[model samples]
Target: MAIAKLDVVALDCPEPRKLADFYAALLGGALVDDEAENGWVVLSTPGGRLAFQESPGYRPPVWPSTEHGQQLHLDLTVEDLDRAEKEVLALGATALDTEDRSRSWRVYADPVGHPFCLCAG
Candidate 1:
């Protein structure tokens, strides 16, 4: 029915391993690397696989404005938004957008500035 199965969602970063490590730590995945130093990294989780490749001049997305544009973003479901927010902040995530009364989702940027959201579902 489908042309092909979805394999991986890859991101480009200056250091592939570091980006992969950040996601693996937050999402509970196993980081895998190839023998050759091809600047490729992967994190395999129960839900899906995320990959990272080295980009010599990687510039993070400038969200809110379409000047640079946001190539992609990730939304994660959390039981307690407040608790998860604190935990993610402690793990080097920078809060891009903070919402108090509107308690649905909060925005944050990874260490390298990729936008992601913690959603209460």
Candidate 2:
């Protein structure tokens, strides 16, 4: 059989609980899974399941450096960039970079240094 669509995308983080909470708040708590625990967290959004795996020795990515490399990133579709950005920042997301703020997209990083983007998709 052919491969099925992606069910989950997991990220490595030092503290799964903290990172998961950030996403949970941003996604309106509807994307979070009931099975999320201290070591592992899962977000079940309409797009797909986003999971965070605990890495005790996890070292965050150093973007623009490319020395360590970005392991993974999430792209979220939004209707309003400005409003979305404000909500994300309030949810513990730090503004890392914005390739085209005037455009329909903006990039931001989570508290643990994982990069994600908001696009008009």
Candidate 3:
């Protein structure tokens, strides 16, 4: 028996709407923008749902460092690595790791500094 079910992955950021829009465009989802909701945004996609929470004092983590480690990172698989990288960079994602040509994955930091991988699966 499962104790609880995993619902949605929420990312904390200074601005919810902007972050939500970024993810919606990347994931091909609709941003559920409710005027009543003050500091949150939800993107509902065919695969799953992503929620962005507003944190006034949000501070992005520094990857590969123990002082401020990555809270969590999304591993997104793509059909073509080259194409995906081009698209993400245009969407304000910074390239974090793309040196190892032997590897099947590349790392990129989202607009809000959250690290995510573009994996070839």
Clashing pairs in 1: none
In terms of TM-score, which candidate is stronger, 1 or 3?
A: 3
lDDT of 1 by residue, 1-121 (tens): 9999999998888888777878887898797654116989888987799988888889999877799987899999988999999999988899989867376999999888889999998
Which tens-of-lDDT digit does each residue in 1-121 have in candidate 2? 8689767889889877677778877775454564446577787765667788888788888775677877777888888888898899888888877756677778788999998888886
Task: Give the Cα error of residue 27 in candidate 3, in Å.
Answer: 0.8
- Model 2 compared with the native: what TM-score? 0.84
As for model 1, its CA RMSD to the true structure in angstroms is 1.5
Give the better candidate number (2 or 3) by lDDT: 3
Q: List the residue pairs that clash in candidate 3.
A: none
**What lDDT is reached at residue 53 by model 2?**
89
User: Better model by lDDT, 1 or 2?
Assistant: 1
TM-score of 3: 0.93
**Stretches of candidate 3 exceeding 4 Å from the true structure:** 33-37
**Candidate 3 residue 116 C-alpha distance from true site, Å:** 0.4
The alpha-carbon lDDT assigned to residue 68 of candidate 2 equals 82
Off by over 4 Å in 1: 34-36
